[model samples]
Target: MRSGGLKRLGLVSGLLAGALALSACSTVGGDQPQQAGQDGGQNASLATKLIMGTPNPPPLSEPVDTQIKRDCPPVDVLDGAAAFRAYATPGSADPFDIRYQASIADTARECSSLGVEAAIRVGVTGRVILGPKGSPGSFRLPLRIAVVDEKGVPVYSRMHPIDVTVPAGQTQADFPHIEDGVVVPIPANRFRGWKIMVGYDPSGATQTRASRAR
Candidate 1:
């Protein structure tokens, strides 16, 4: 009986020792990066690019083959055009008549030169706030994106209607608006006060909707 008990104890000890050795090999310092990766961090980097409103720029280590002599102008939201008030009654000026208000929160743009013309992608980040008469639902916000010269003349303009969906329990909704491939003649100098403008244009949205209705 004593011999059989000792033989069983020896077998158990061997198994435990092998398990410890295998575990130590798996946890070696050299394999830390691989072992810790939850699959990999590549998806996280991609998500960061979306939040940044553009693709990741080339790494500094990678030399540029050709550099375009151009610049991206600053984006602006004008005071009068930044906000739009939606009222229950058309053409109503009463404060109590406001159903909701949509406004621009931020803007960004990127520029690339295509030989003669510069291609730009402008982005507008905005929010819709609930007013006295507003309720949680979907809303269409009219966005006007334009490139204006120093004299406030629009060199290029485009109308973009963004959909904002506020959840059933939410009082507001945030939306991202991007207008891509806006081509313009390359300016002689980037600092010539060219402006990328974005704003709420209810008239433009209304006209588009009216046309669709017809």
Candidate 2:
């Protein structure tokens, strides 16, 4: 009789432990999907849309004549006037398509005593659409970009060459590229607007020039 009682007690304890474990597991499983959904929501809120357009014609007659210059004294031509003319050439047999998009947010770190440290996340994608209607192309084009302040002063600049190939007769070739984030130490003084520009050369031209706006 005593042996039977001890056996029964052990069996009951084991069953209770199993039940508790199963309950804990079910609770954890139920919460996982909710957590994932919350993460997705956060990501959506953080994403900002960026739109790109050429406010004016390219600076130079040819893409090769385009130039980017930096750190000039105030009142100097930040970007040379002729530079625009160089890039302002007739559209290609297959027009080149370029787009610039950026996500801007306040950085956690402050640059000056006034808390001026700000960071902007920028992404640039360029595509060489072949044909008159901007159909897809088989060649990849190299590109250059710059970040300018509201006064038309260039604060940061970088170049990236992307290679993409589309089969002939395709309507479009999409080369989605992301530009690295830009962190600018804010000046103590108030400032105007900030702008970003991206350019491409489908003809394999490599010349570039830039100037700072006064």
Candidate 3:
């Protein structure tokens, strides 16, 4: 590669890194809804219709643009619950028994600010990497999307059951999940402190078949 090409590559990488640094919260992003707030089935584009792992949870769609919407809450991913690691063994760290690992790559949102209540649409994008013991097949990717006020008060939170499939001959792919119609009532003075949060929720993950190595 030429020096100019190298510089261009470096610049692109730097730009990408800088975008992910938008906040100390949200996007290592992954999750599940406990009680349904709104059925995303209609507006969910790639949830069950996508074509890529680095992009699917049975989820993930295209690469999400981290751009924020005006008059709307921003989407965020929790740092601690960013990635989901599944082991072939019940509770062992043996690398050979590793199944697959999934992570949140980006997030986006659209908020409705015209009425006394706000409706927000949140989307999460990510990928899955197959491990040594992992195979090309369907796997569960747990995720949780939550909402909170600016003061850190809980507004809406739920777990969403998401999954991704590893197609034949592919070691990995992309996934994108979008939840639509998250409505929150606006208070007096029109103070909007709502934020959409996304992350990996292991508690909602399906029980994996662990190896005897445990």
Point to the candidate with the largest TM-score. 1
- State the lDDT at 212 in candidate 2: 16
Ten contiguous residues with the weakest lDDT in model 3: 1-10
Candidates in order have lDDT scores of: 0.55, 0.30, 0.55
Query: lDDT tens digits, residues 26-111, model 1?
Result: 01111111111233322222212223333332322321222332355666665578777788787888878877787654445556
lDDT of 2 by residue, 70-146 (tens): 11111111221101111223442222332211111101111112235444343332223333333343333445445
Instruction: Report the lDDT tens digits of candidate 3 across residue range 1-214.
Output: 0111111111121121111211223332222221011343222222122211111123223223322223456566676777777888878788788898786665555555535676667766566778898999988777888888878777888887676877899777556677875777765534366567788887766433232123
Model 3 C-alpha RMSD to native: 11.7
Over all chains combined, what TM-score does candidate 3 have?
0.63
Stronger candidate by lDDT (2 vs 3): 3
Kindly give the stretch of ten consecutive residues in candidate 2 with the minimal lDDT sum.
Answer: 17-26
lDDT for model 3 comes to 0.55
